[model samples]
Target: MVSLPSTLERIRTRLILLALFLMPWQTRWIFGTDTLSGGISEFGVLSFFVVEGLIVLAFVLQPFIEHHRDFDGAVTLGWVMMLAMLASVFSASNPHLAMMAWLHVLGAYVLFLNLLNRHVKPKEALFAFTLGLVAPALLGVFQAVTGSSPASTLLGLASHDAMTAGASVIETFSMRWLRAYGSFQHPNVFGGYLAVGLFAVFLFLRWDVSKKARMGAYAVGALLTATLVLTYSRSAWIAFVLSSVLAGWLLFLHHRVELRRVIPLGLIILFVMGFTATLFSNPYVVALEETHPGREVYAYQPVHNLYLLMLSELGVIGTLFVLLWMVLIDRYIFANLPRVGAVGALAIGSALFIIGFFDHYLWSLWPGLALVAFVLAMTLRLSEPGVEKE
Candidate 1:
């Protein structure tokens, strides 16, 4: 039987879930015109703040709702180092942005601790969290097909003015028309976003969800993947491939359950490969000046830029620390908390890491920072006993 506090905690948890799922819309300023940052969209502004508030609420209620804690000292240390590095490395780019990013990380950690401690059930968390991504995935497809129509207009296509502007931009000069960036600033970011969504939906399919839920997940995943390809973002393409491989590997891990699953997935992959080969031969892919710009001058931009992004914005020394920090976090969680949910979170983190290869999520202070924090908190909380995970 649930106590009054526990019942209230559940309500709070539900509200927090609603807040998170609403972040993209609010940040994007979808339904409303007013925002916290003057006329600027509220969606972007709320993404970090809403998630942060939820974290605080969770932490405050943790003791009341949870009976135990599963945070490993090693993981905690890594997280601390990660936070410190972000503050130092990103200071040069924009100190305020850097600090905000760090704060998001901190907030996520608090949220993670609370979740692991038992503020929310695993199924509730998964459904609520995945719903957030799913909405954006659908929106992205809608936006892309129609050409990023005005924030208000859902269909038709983006205004001719916006498309012209997008085509004129130097960074995306090669793009023929506007692509759906959804609430994000760039097509690449949207692609990365969809990649993570694909993973979540794919994972759901493998879980004990109803046939309808599983089928819906598969459809959403496929739609997101197809829309991502339409973005024509090379980075998103790489992320998708890596995400697909990871999901396939995870699905195959329980090989004896269904050999039929692996067989069809394999064939589909082969077909995709052939299709990709044909597409690469198209003059469009070959026409680009450089797949990744500015790399030719330094040749170092590939590795050095990422390192600089981590160090200069986070600090030189701090960037180096992340390797140890993440490893420690992985080891501690895997060693003491062997739940499937924890494993799934780690896998998702890995998918994001791959996504980071092309985009600089670590460079911002909102969604990226919040995402990392949420991942850590989920891992820690799911490790605790009495929690049904993944």
Candidate 2:
């Protein structure tokens, strides 16, 4: 998108932003699936989604875009990851599943590279993302308030009956309600999206934009925060809260000498999480599994933890490389991203890492994968130094 003439580049930026704005819609075409319950499991299906098509278009355009060579570390890590995923296919429990997973991983890696190379501004990226959240957030709020989820093929919603065995719902002693799913396949997915959406809006508000823009961000943030609660996704709730605290902490300690304090806090948080997981593995696994249609070990479920899921998918060597990749990315040049933007990016990255400890969707599911890539590219770009005065 960057190599075009100035006028053309501007148009292309609009188009790319449009793609980001529409990327969350779940519309797709299914090619095939593995038989589960005499039908294709949604997870096992080979489908080409609308978002995937947009990503493919961007991928195809990537070679033509001009790039700065400042991101050798990120680029090298991407290639290493692609290689690892390609290798993992042979050893995966299901070859077809593995290939599909690899394909999405490749997409995510490509998307991350594309965004960073093209140089989308932090505010622009945040604006596009939060704008995209509007429709889904509104729909989610409606679903939560009415306790109904009407089917709409075009909108990517399926009718959700709380009484259905496979439906996601909240049950109290006297009443039960369907958890809002928006256009996502599950409430946790919806909540996860909203959690980040809220963060995006929060950051957008902090920028010195027009009053009207700030008002819009406030409205969207409120919607996202309210609907996030309705989804009742504990993982998403924790992710949002931790992200807020991390952001505030990073901002407070942006100085290099003070940044070291993050290490101990991070270590303590990890130790507590690890201990809690170990102490409650039995009931925690049960609760995690019961959130969806139950899965037997034969059918298999990705471990609730993202790190464990990565270890399983990528093996020890691959996982080690992935960890190294993350470290390398953090070392990428902090270009023109404003100080606040950079701190916000770092905080969100930490949040994602923490969420990974409790959820696998960012690695195991398509929507989760794409959304992570989206946020990650923004974070990567924002990490670059931008200390411009308003």
Candidate 3:
């Protein structure tokens, strides 16, 4: 008869092999060449809430709740915060529309939390997460190099989807295409996703158990950096630099590494100079000046007003509540880094912080917000003691 230890070993081996089989990440979805049928069949078709429902049931039915009981309070608190924001939207003019929008946000977060907890371990989460971005990263590279857009045939995403169309292509000295948006609906979203994934890879390089694995982790990190640059997202560009500094500082307290000192400073200088240049060099800057007297009209009104939008939608009190949550997360991670392992959690937190700047990422109305929520949940869970099971 096989002993319990031997039985566990067999299961572990099978799980590792299964993860390896799914490493490429691009195989999960199909892309297409045109809009209409392709978009309708792919993007317009599936209900992400259906996916959330199944996972919620699975979590509810777990026989030994004690195994995951530590996280129950945190998770419950997060849900309450989200529900409160939804209630505010319901108080708006259009009740039906507000409810629909709120449901989308809630459903996305639930799906993210559920999928992450059910499917990913701390070690495998990075790999599984990387697999999610691999296809988009590769396609984004191809798009950058060739200036060929992925055919809008299958995944149902197109160049004109509010996020991708006008701002997708950025003119550069090297004749660069717009940053590769990949599977995301827009370049900014793609930039946000790529930036987050690359940071995870960077953290993995620092914390991975095996020497051989570090090489692969670093390679993925480099690829993600390249993808982030090519996407030409100025907001993302700024966020990456800021988050890297914050992440390095957090991780340095725990690990005391040399490269962390060098890399963040270099990135800060590079991104600051480049982003400054882009702002001045773009002809659109001149066009905006011509159309609107004050630069604030172009800069602060629509694009740079994410915080103002938050205040408008959630009101002053609600906005403060959300901002306080951000502060709490930072304090929690800082306090718990030694017990929880700071590398990946720090990187994930930094990436999300950066993503939140230009986009209303914390709001959770968009589908990509689900991906961000998943990263946050995974980071929080990994940071918690005794969360990972054998």
TM-scores, one per candidate:
0.71, 0.81, 0.69
Error of 3 at 28 (Å): 14
**Which lDDT tens digits does candidate 2 get at residues 6-55?**
65555556656776787668888877787644666676877777767766
Instruction: Give the distance in Å from residue 82's predicted Cα in candidate 3 to where it truly belongs.
Output: 3.6
lDDT for each candidate structure: 0.53, 0.69, 0.55
User: Candidate 2, TM-score vs. the true structure?
Assistant: 0.81
Stretches of candidate 1 off by over 4 Å are 1-4, 26-48, 61-70, 82-98, 152-162, 166-175, 246-254, 258-307, 332-346, 377-390
Model 3 misplacement above 4 A: 1-70, 115-119, 159-167, 171-176, 209-212, 257-305, 316-328, 338-340, 361-365, 386-390
Q: What is the lDDT of candidate 3?
A: 0.55
* Backbone clashes under 3 angstroms, per model: 17, 9, 8
- Least lDDT summed over 10 consecutive residues: which range in candidate 2? 276-285
Q: After TM-score superposition, what is the CA distance of residue 171 in candidate 3 from its true location, in Å?
A: 4.3
Report the lDDT tens digits of candidate 1 across residue range 175-258.
444455655556665666565565555445445667677556655655665556655666656766665565446545644353
Winner on TM-score between 2 and 3 is 2
Top-lDDT structure, candidate number: 2
